[model samples]
Target: MISSIFFYSTAFVLFLIGLFGVLTRKNIIKILVSLSITETAVNLFLVTVGYIKNGKAPILTNTIGSIGMNNLKFVDPLPQALVLTAIVIGLGTTALSLVIAIKLYKNYGTLNITKMGGKR
Candidate 1:
């Protein structure tokens, strides 16, 4: 229980920090970084949910389970599937964010969104 608490607490802290950055930061690059952080935290939390003691790989073959101890448990496939989709979507979002950031930098000469209207 202590390990579980620590793990979830860390995850919560990461998520909170990201949320704070996204909500309070003015820099466009900072916002993008924060968004990426939020994605990572969420993914980590999701993967944690599927964790099991003495977890074994999810293989359908009979050979794998033959030698397995009684305590061995298969990892939940749902979390794996969700994590994979999150990875793909995260990649797409990161690529698109970079492209947008590049375009913004080229236009404004700086990453600050507060000065987006042009220099004073």
Candidate 2:
């Protein structure tokens, strides 16, 4: 019970911190890092949500002899699968953003958005 609460709270706090960083930071690289942090928080939250106390993996084994699925306590797999996909997508997005940031830096010679905009 306590562990569950802690996991959820930690995920929420991480997400909030990432959001704050993205909203307040001016450097493109910092913003990309913030976005990755947000992705991590989301993935953690999803995995946490799928957790079951004292539950076994979603797999079948001979140990469970004649007992059927109705009697077994197995952790949900959907959230885990979704999180895996999300992780891959997040990696791709982060890579793309990094490439774009590199292009922007090469063009403007600065990673700061405001500075790139010709502002003082």
Candidate 3:
């Protein structure tokens, strides 16, 4: 439940920030940074989805005299899978955005996005 709340809250905040950047920011770099923040927040939420409360490692150990194998809670596999996917996606997004930012910076010769292609 806590994870759910955190995930949603972080996502929402990131969304708002991204929207703000999209709506109000003139600089492409600032917009890109905001986009990255949103992406990171989403990735964070995705990775957090894999967390298991009180979950034990997936390693197997010899059973004790009377204990059964049923009580142990193995790490949840779903979250781990999701995290991996999110990581890949995040990397792709970062690379793509960085490339775009570089292009814009090179063309404009300045980091200020509003000034980009100003004389164009």
Candidate 4:
């Protein structure tokens, strides 16, 4: 199986790429997309944080019979639950931001952030 380090590195790279896109891109829609990427990276990182090697689900089963707490190797569920909640919130925020972007485009006739307000 793949190690948690791989997941962590992947998440870090995604976050960096997203940050670069947000910082360097001029279009409002692209920035929103980058923000979504960053959100996804964060979610991935959170999930990775809860990983446990050789861990089983927290649920007790008859198949794993008579296992004591000291021998239990259940992976953490809190981070997974938090990531789920974050995903929902991120979806809502992304939709709201996209709607705002549409309104901005309608008003300015352009999606370029620098051009929206005319010459500086």
- lDDT by residue (1-120, candidate 2, tens digit) is 567788899999999999999999999999999999999999999999999987789888988646876788888999999999999999999999999999998899999988887533
Model 2 worst lDDT run, 10 consecutive residues: 62-71
Q: Which sequence of candidate numbers ranks them by lDDT, best first?
A: 4, 2, 1, 3
* lDDT for each residue of candidate 4 in 41-111, tens digit (9 for 90 to 100): 99999988998999998788886667767888988999999999999999999999999999888888899
| lDDT digits (tens) for residues 39-95 of candidate 1 | 888888887788775667777667765766564588787988999999899999989
* lDDT, each prediction: 0.83, 0.91, 0.72, 0.92
Off by over 4 Å in 1: 60-63, 68-71, 118-120
Better of 3 and 4 by TM-score: 4
- The TM-scores, one per candidate, come to 0.83, 0.89, 0.66, 0.89
lDDT of 3 by residue, 8-94 (tens): 688778878877886788777677778777777776666556657676666677753235677777676776677778778878987
For model 4, which pairs clash?
Answer: none
- Give the lowest summed-lDDT range of ten residues in model 4: 111-120
**RMSD of every prediction:** 2.8, 2.4, 3.6, 2.1
Tell me which of candidates 2 and 3 scores higher on lDDT: 2
